[model samples]
Target: MVNLINQLSMPLVEVALVLQKHITALMTTLQEHLDAAQQSANANVVKPWPLDVEAAESSTNFPVEKVMKVVDSQRMDILETLIRVTLIEIDASIIEGLLALRSWEHLVRTQLALAKGPGQLFSPLDIPEDW
Candidate 1:
């Protein structure tokens, strides 16, 4: 039988292996962010936004199914969908924070894919721009 690892270039294979280690940690972080959001919602949703948003913020119900899907897959795309859908469900006029957490995660994966693909610089895997 052909080895699956052999199908990938060694650097990319290693990157995948490295990323596998973070699924659990990222899940924990995902939960923490959700918890924080819940806390903010519980405390004062209007404060998280701005202006007279009490009317707009009165209703918010994150879909359990979508959230559970992200929890199961531990994928950023799924989480992004959950965030976007949930915000839309609540009719959020403006979001206070951006979700570049997933984008940063994606950039790391991209860098890994380009590890040996071409002229790639050794960019530090640090937080990109902002969280």
Candidate 2:
């Protein structure tokens, strides 16, 4: 592996580096989105009280109706944003993984060709399942 990396041309090495950076960034962004989703979900606490208006009015323990209404509104907005962001992040991560896989595959093919003649390269062989 060291020899392969050392033998790679500048352009190929740059390609590998770019792919690594993209994968790292995509993973970090995905983690941030997951954290944002958790924070949004935890931002609101739901408390239920007896439905009787007299009891609800008499108790100051329960949240005020106005406050509950505002909280609900914010919760809806957060939920919408979370869903959109999560979907976008998931798509980006999948694409990044695929890109990295493709890049490595190409690099392996190039390295193999350099190590052995093209005619001797990539022969199909069956391996025993048990090593």
Candidate 3:
């Protein structure tokens, strides 16, 4: 029984370990992208205009549209990363739930077997036919 439990649990542990590694990789990638985007934006800052009347006015005026566009684009990228991470987390939860269910099923079956004594046996057919 212990061996059976161990065998069933080993795969679940492996899957969790793999998922952790994947999440770590994704977080690292997200950080790198964010850093690169920030550096790119900073490096691409518009230069000040010449001292002519129109140029001076334009330089002094706030570029609301350009700033908004940069903000929106960066927000979208961050949202995308968040959505991906959320999906990974949901998948991990599902896998963990399945493992828990399997463990519970094994425990119930073991209890039944012990209660029914050594020579006696239990089978799936013992369950209700409708089930």
lDDT of 2 by residue, 54-131 (tens): 211121233345333433334334433443355466774444443433444344334433433322222221122441
Count backbone overlaps in model 2: 0
Global Cα lDDT for candidate 1: 0.36
Q: How much is 129 displaced in model 3, in angstroms?
A: 20
Whole-model lDDT values for every prediction: 0.36, 0.37, 0.35
> What is the lDDT for 64 in model 1?
45
Structural similarity to truth (TM-score) of each candidate: 0.23, 0.26, 0.23
Which parts of model 2 have CA positions greater than 4 angstroms off?
1-10, 38-131
Clashes of each: 0, 0, 0
TM-score of 1: 0.23
TM-score of 2: 0.26
| 2 against 3, candidate with superior TM-score | 2
- State the lDDT of candidate 3 residue by residue for 25-79, as single tens digits: 5445544766788742221111111222221112233344543443333433443
